[model samples]
Target chain A: MALVEIKNVRKSFGALEVLKDVSLTVEEGEIVTIIGRSGSGKSTLLRCINGLEDIQDGEIRVEGQQVHGQMKKLRELRQKVGIVFQAFNLFPHLTVERNITLAPIRTGRVSKADARALAEKVLAQVGLSEKIDAYPEQLSGGQQQRVAIARCLAMSPDLMLFDEVTSALDPELVGEVLKVMEDMASRGMTMILVTHEMAFARDVATKIVFMHQGRVWEEGPPSELFSSPKTPELKSFIGSNH
Target chain B: MQNLNFQQVLRYQDEFLHGIVNTLEMTAIAAFFGLLIGVVGAVLVGSGPKPVRILVKAYIELIRNTPPLIQLFVIFFIFPSAGIRLAPFPAACVALSIYFGAYAIEIIRSGLASIPKSQVEAGECLGLTRFEVFRYVVLAPALRNIYPSITSQLILLLLGTSVASQIAAEELFHTATFVESRTFRSFEVYALISAIYVALVVASRVIFAIVGAVAFRWPVRR
Candidate 1:
């Protein structure tokens, strides 16, 4: 079975249906890149996987635990899932190291010293070891985003979700963040990212899911989808990017 | 200004000093507990069960709607009718704490609301429990945003402590009244009291500012 499973999920905001009949699966060690235009529900789908957003119909499961309703069940599932947002969302009051270590420590699964060690390791992974003591405000947008990723990584999550993580960075800073993500993929982390960087998707994704009109319209190996253009929407999306 | 004899005022310094102490004590107690109420109300009422949330909302509205002086009167004078007698000082603190907390609840709760929902999402994604999210992620940034507002309300809370003197709590303002009756120098006494009040207000701001620096640990601007 796949690590994550969503079966015929539906979500709506008042009268507006945001996600309709959305179903997908993610296997272990697969780097799946979800690509789409703005408001294509790419970000919403990623949030659903982490139980950040509710699904009105069908079910979402991570490691076979239901991801809908019930707060305790959601928190239990949340431990295995790490999500990085475009906003960075670093706790403004905490130092960078504390931001990274806090969840790990609160879980009581790791000691304070161990959490510190884990923070150092992840910070180094993102090439941000020097910023251990600095607060989020002190860093550039890219740097702060990197700290956010390290904060997620410190939890040792089984699956990681990225919601348009590089969309908020300046063009000059986008490469560094994409590079870190590419490195994570190479290290065999199971990552599903909703991103706009088609080039990066092509380079790093094991599979690319093209979403159009609230559904996974086209999905395949990066080479196949990027080259063959399975649907008119994918073709135009790919065409527009170049 | 003819009766503004500096010598007479100096003679009543001991009484004035004692009143100043009472005012400071009651105000400090009120401010401290008011802040506590604000924090607890903000966190609990935001995430609480429906009935609990409604109860909190009612309290917030009730205190906010009524004048604080009447609230103080109720505690000091009215409650005794039902046999729940409170000393004047404690009664004053209780009234001001509830009254100040009403405005504080609104301020801090809005500050909590202003925290980007994504930050709370990040906490949950990282698997911190709800309480952990409130304590670490939600509260500090929320309070940091409203620190200035809190200082302003605190100075007001201190001035309101003078109202406690009507119940014979003998706070700074009350002591001024005592000295005024003795010297018949009403303007002189009040002017001196105002200076002292200003000094106290300035000191409170500095203290809370230092606290903001330490607790927020973020730069002045978010």
Candidate 2:
């Protein structure tokens, strides 16, 4: 069984269709990078997988259990699958330590006494142990994004989703966040990433999924997708990114 | 101008003291209820079902559109005719709370609106329950965002307590009227009460600033 399975997922926004019968599977420990233009439904598809957005049609299952829109079911699914957003939406009122430990402590996954240790462990993983006492605004953009990843990592999720995480970062700041992601990939974390960084996709992605017009335009190893483009869309996409 | 005889106004020191105490007590009671109603109404208006939203909206509009004096008159005067008889003080508190709550809902709702959707989504993604998301992620920041406006409304509510005197609540304004009726020192009495109002406003602002510093101590840019 696949770690994540999205089948025939059709989502629409009122009069506009965002995702059209999108189907994909993510096996365990596979870093699947989804690259697409804005409005191509890549982000929408990722949101659907975690039940953040309801689907008009189709099924998304993780670890053999179907994702449902029920509050309890969505909470359970989210506990297993964590997502890092583009804006690094850290809780502004909370210190970094509180931001990372709020869920784990509230959900009874960790006790109050142990929450500090748990927060320390995750912050260290993202090389932000020094910022445990700082607020989100105190950190640089890259640092805040790292803290966001740490916040997700603190959940001990089986799968992590990155939704254009680096797209909002300054050019110089993007590499640090990608470095943390690279570290996660090396440690065998299953990740589905929607990103514009083709180089990072080529380096870290086990398989690349190119999306166009709300469809997977191509799916192959990075070398195949880059070296031998089968479609004009993919060809132009790769060419333009260069 | 003739000499201001503050010495004669000061002859009614006990009356002035009682007035100050009553005014403070009424403001405190009304503030507590107003804060409660404002927060709950804001949440309901923002996320409650259509019917509930409409009901809360109606309440807010009704209170906001009408003058508090009229509302107080209805609660104090009309409610008695309908078999619900509240004394002068309780009636004033209720009227003031309802009045302050309406504007507070608008102020707090704007604060809640200022919180971006992405921030709430981040909390939901972490598996925080809906209430937990509001409490931990959204509440403090939203409150902080509108702290100044809410506090200003509170000061206005404090001043609005003067309206309660019309119902014979014997708060500051009513006490002043009684003093003036007896002493005929209208200028001195009015001047003294105005100074007290200024002092009260300034003192409350200081208190709010201290509370805000402690509650929202996170290193936000604002």
Candidate 3:
């Protein structure tokens, strides 16, 4: 069975529809990068996978359990599937160490005594071990983003979703965040990212999906999709990004 | 401006000291209880059931729209007619606390609203429960965001304690009234009490500043 399955999901916001019949499947240890213009429903699809947004129709299952419905069920699904947002929404009142350990300790995944070691391990994974005591505001944008990833890593999720995690970073800072993600991908972590970094997508993505007009316009290996453009939308998108 | 004679006013130093102690005691109690109500009311307004939300909303509206003096009157005078009699001091405390509560609720509610939705969503993404999200992620920052406004409201509550004088509560203003009538040195008496009020406001500001510094020691985002 696939690690994540999104089937015919339809989501609407009042009069406007954001995602229409979006279906995709992600196997374990696969790094899938989704690229599209803004308002193409790419981000919405990522959010729905972890039950962040309620779907109007269809189903999303992570590890064979349904993603939406009861709060208890969504909480269970969220534990297995972690999402990092565009805004590194770290708790401003807490130190980086406390921010990382809060979820693990609260969910009973780790005891208070072991929380310090758990935080250190994840912070090290993001190459930010020295910033364990620093607050979110004390770090640079890239550092904060790395801390956000570390916070998610602390959960030990089976799948990670990156929703434009680097979009809010400075151009100079973007590479550090991408490097951290590349390291995670090399470790065989299953990650699905919504990003506009065409070069990084081509190099790091095991599979690249092109979404246009609320649908998957094209999807294939990075070589095939980038080398030979099938749809005009994908071709134009690639041309514009390059 | 005429003949300022503070010497006569100073003769009643004991009475003035008693009044100062009483006012501070009442203000402390009212402010503490009022803050408690404000936090609980803010939460209920944000996420409580429909009936509860409406009930809290109605309470906030009712107390906000009415005058604190009249509320005190109701508690001190009207309650006695209805078989609920409270002494002057206790009646003043009850009325002042409730009065402060009404404004505190709105102030705190605004603070809660000021927190970005992304902050709460981030907590939810971590599999924290709804209450946990509010407690761990939302509450402190929200309070921090509105720290100034709430503290100012607390100062206003302290000033509002003067209204309890109308009920013969023997707080600062009530003592001023007594001394003024006896000494007939209204100018000196009013002048001295005005300085004392200013001193009290300054003292509260220093206290709040210290509290704010301690509670929110984390660096703020630029």
The numbered model that scores best in DockQ is: 2
Predicted candidate 2 versus true structure: per-residue lDDT over B1-222, tens digit per residue: 478789999999899889989999999999899989999999999999999999999999999999999999999999999999999999999999999889989999999999999888999899989999999999998999999999998899889999999989989999999999999999999999999899999999999999999998887774
Error of 1 at B33 (Å): 2.1
Off by over 4 Å in 2: B1-3
**lDDT (10s digit) by residue, model 3, range A142-185:** 99999999999999999999999999999999999999999999
lDDT of each residue in A7-40, candidate 2, tens digit only: 9988999988888888899999999999988999
lDDT of 3 by residue, B1-222 (tens): 777889999999999999999999999989888888988998999889999999999998889999999999999999998999999999999898888888888989998899999998999999999989989999999899889998998888878889999999989999999999999999899899999999999999999999999999999856
Worst 10 residues of 1 chain A by lDDT: A108-117
DockQ of 1: 0.74
Q: Is the docking of candidate 3 incorrect, acceptable, medium or high quality?
A: medium
User: In candidate 3, how many Å is residue B145 off?
Assistant: 1.8
Off by over 4 Å in 3: B1-11, B81-83, B181-184
- Displacement of residue A195 (Cα, Å) in model 1 is 1.4
Per-residue lDDT tens digits of candidate 1, residues B24-133? 99988898899889888877788889998999899999998998889999998899999989998899989999998988888899899988888888898888888889
